[model samples]
Target: MDVLIVGAGPTGLTLGIDLARRGVDALVVERAEALFPGSRGKGIQPRTQEVFEDLGVLDAIRAAGGPYPVRAIWKDGERIGEQPMFEPVEADESAPYTEPLMVPQWRTQEVLYARLVELGGRVAFGHELTGLEQDAEGVSARFADGSAVRARYAVAADGGRSAVRRALGVAMTGETVDPSPFLVADLRMTGLDREYWHTFPRPDGTGLALCPLAGTDDFQLAGKFPEGTEFDLSLDGVRRLVAAYTHLDAEDVTELRWASDFRPRAALADRFRVGRVFLAGDAAHVHSPAGGQGLNTSVQDAYNLGWKLGAVLKDGAPEPLLDTYEEERRPNAAAMLGLSTGVHRGEVQRGKATVQLGLGYPESALSEDRRAAPAGVRAGDRAPDGRVDGVRLFDAFRGPHWTLLGAPAAAAGVHALPAAPKSYGPGVFLVRPDGYVGWAGDSAEGLGAYLARAGVR
Candidate 1:
């Protein structure tokens, strides 16, 4: 196997599918044999949907589920302000893919699992990664089966304990601040007028939030608490909260589905890559699910790493490209952490990049001389989309693959692939499989210059 993936959850499955789609040999090993039907997260961000569309999973996702409706916040069972969960995305036909759509996390996982199987790569069930040993060329992973498999690299998409990360000796450092306990319950709401999100506040001031299930009036209730205050809500406890928070009564609580407690965790690994062993998704960083960014960030993390790993392992192995896995993503990780913990991404990232964001970095091998900006969009950054022949390429066509967004003639300097986007973002821009602008070219000269610097020449 080219890569051994730990944890057959969303992130691992996504990584496996991406690598397999590109003809890379990758295997995902899960501790369990069957797909987890209990859905923890149901809200798929629009940005996430954009990614799904790129992966060719959006239509199936939308068909299986529905859209994410605007949700309401609540405290002590009282309604408060609504959140900016989803925005109206202008349907841009010229783009590679479409905007966001919402679905259950299990649905998302199932789609990726099916796709991986379709691509001739399957997730090994009951193969929990218990240990790892690596050398200069490859790594051998020990599973609970008392057997081991060798691969050039390993992706630790496993949950927090992360056997792969520990084996590699990567240090993850951060404070577990505000240990605000919260529980998420996913289920269908019955016997109520199907309306927008219903929110309420906890009077005791422990914590508060109420949101509509993605695309429906079904509910996902969130409650925060300080220290210990019966954080885990039982079916009856959940029913009580629903009744107190809204006018709905206990009898209306049709189903008391899966529920679990989690602390608002915020942390970042000191390193994402250590030789052949790397980390992606929750394994590297765990933050509060408050902003609905955990799963989305994990998907993007794998998206960013998959192509680079494939490039290095296959052909056109640019040594410098591997270094970018940390340079570009570390800061991005920091920004995500700051957002969840209320640290903020400084003024620049907040004011400019927060909206029309692009990537920025100081030490990217992709950006040598010639003075373009950094790798990812930070503060004061405006996101750049693509266009071709005066036609704008929107979010409909983007998938988890390399995309060219200009006339093949105009997009010189970069890899002159046979197919390209007619009208996309900036002039001669190279979008990472994860949908961030990696290499930018203003004109033919800039394109040529950047390609030369990036060793694409």
Candidate 2:
């Protein structure tokens, strides 16, 4: 296989879809017997929506989710004032998606997995990695079931407690964002309307909130506990906690679908790549759920790495092209970790930064801007949505191919959008397969060299 993905969550499944679409042989393995069965990581930010669109799962994702609702503060068994959960952002031509969508993490994974299978990809459930060894050429992974598989490269998407990362001896440095224990669960209940997210704050620092999960008859219940408290995850314990905190009776929680508890924390892997092994998703970084950055950052990690791997494995790009993965993503992950921690501590609001539409790699080795008077979009920026000669920029960039805008001459192996978008000003821009501008110039002066280095014939 070209790649061995050691998880089947959103990260690994997304990488599987990208690689499969590029005709790269990749396999996703998950220790769990099935997809994740909870509503964890339920917020899909706008940037991730663009990724899903490119992967051809946006329609299904939209059908399975809805916009976040306003927060309804409550006290003394009565509804209080309503407040917007996120700062408002208007959709424009440059950014069509402005808000996060609420899709249960499990449902998101389902959509990604289905797309992967549609692209002729496969996931091996029950295959737990017990050992991983990498040499100069490839990586070999041994499973708990005594089976093994070898591939040119391996990605650790197995999550925060990733066995693959542990086997690779990668250290994670982090700090506790919140010392207090927290609990979250998906359940069916009564007494609360499904329109607003009901939050009940108490005199003490402890509180509980029930937010109706979109596209399902379930509400996600989250509660905070005092430090050193041993919170219970059982259904009865959840009922008692809810009854004590709010006006509803314990029986109001009719069905408990899933439950889990943890203390919010932020951590980043010391390194993203170890020879032939690369870490992606929660395996690389763990974040506090605030600002909803964890899963989105993880998915983007797979997106940034997917095309580079495809270039190397399928298009004969140089091996050094893969090194940019760490150089570009590790810093981005660290920034997001800080943002997540900030949101958790109420230091930052969930607005433009949280949407993540402005993320790009302006300082990477691949980004080359030869234009003397660069303006509008530059090298390493995301190619925005616009129209050039009646062709939608996003439509031109949809497939597993590089897009060249304002090309003065024919490039051998790139989709050419001859006319430049009016919003982009005037320049020749070479957009990478991952949708970031790799090179920009006035008249294709340095374009050939950039393309040659990126393995674009």
Candidate 3:
């Protein structure tokens, strides 16, 4: 195989979809018997929605999710006031998804797994990686069930406590963002209105939030425990927690589908690449689920690494192309860790930073803007969505191919299409397969040479 992806969560599944669409031989393996059942990482940011759109899962995702509702505060069983869950932003032609979508993480995984299968990708359930070894030629993984697979590259997306990451001897340096232990449960409940995310706050810096999970009758209940408190993970435990924090009785929480407890912490791997083995998703960087950056950033990690792997394995690109994955993603992950931590500490609100629309690789080696004075969009920026002639910019940039806007040079392998969009200003924009402008110049004077350096032509 070309790539062996550990952990069949959103990160691995997304990478599977990206690689399968590129006709690369990749396999995703999950330690669990099925997809995650919890509504963890439920908020899908706008930028990740764009990625889902490109991967052909946006329709299903949109159908399965809804926008975040207002947060309804409660005190002494009386409704206080409502506040916007996320700072609202108007949608524009350049960015269609201005707000984050609230879908259960399980549903997002289902959609991604389905799309991956549709694109001829395969995932092995109950395949736990017990050992991993990598050499110059390829990587070999051994599973707990006495099974093994070898591939040219391996990725660890198994999560924060990733065994693959541990096997690689990588250190994750981090600190606990909050000392309080948190409990999150997905349960069907009564007596609570589904229109808002109900929150009950205590003066001790602990609180409970019951958010109605979109497309399902269940609500995700998140509760913070006092220091040194030992919480249970049962149906009755969820009932007790809700009743203790709110006016609702223990019986109000009718059912508990799934529940988990954790301490919010932010951690990043010391290194993203370990020879032929690479780390992605929570394995690479674990974020406090505050700004909704954990899952979104993890999915984009796969998105950033997918094209590079495909290029080296299938497009005859140099091995050094793979190096850019760490170079680009590690720093971005670090920034997101800070953002997530800031949101956790209430130092930042869920607004433009949470939406993650402005993330780009302006300093990447593959990014270059030769213009003396760039007009609108510059290299290493996200290729905006707009109409150039009759073709939508996003539509033109979709698929596993590079796109050229405003420049009709047929000399390179990139598809030169219609005029540049107004959002992109006036310049020849060479968009990468992953929807970032790789090169922007006045014309196609050095287009071929730039493409050659990236091994795209």
Q: How accurate locally, in lDDT, is each candidate? A: 0.63, 0.92, 0.91
By lDDT rank, best first, the candidates go: 2, 3, 1
The TM-score ranking, best first, is 2, 3, 1
Candidate 1 lDDT over 56-174, as tens digits, reads 67777787667555555644445556764434445444223233445667777888888889889878898877788888989988888899999988889987778777888888888
Better of 1 and 3 by lDDT: 3
| Of 2 and 3, the candidate ranking higher by lDDT | 2
What pairs collide in candidate 3?
Answer: none
Supply every candidate's count of residue pairs whose N, Cα or C atoms clash at under 3 angstroms: 52, 0, 0
lDDT by residue (214-299, candidate 3, tens digit) is: 99899999888898888888888788888889999999888899999999999999999989999999999999999899999999
**TM-score of every model versus the real structure:** 0.80, 0.99, 0.98
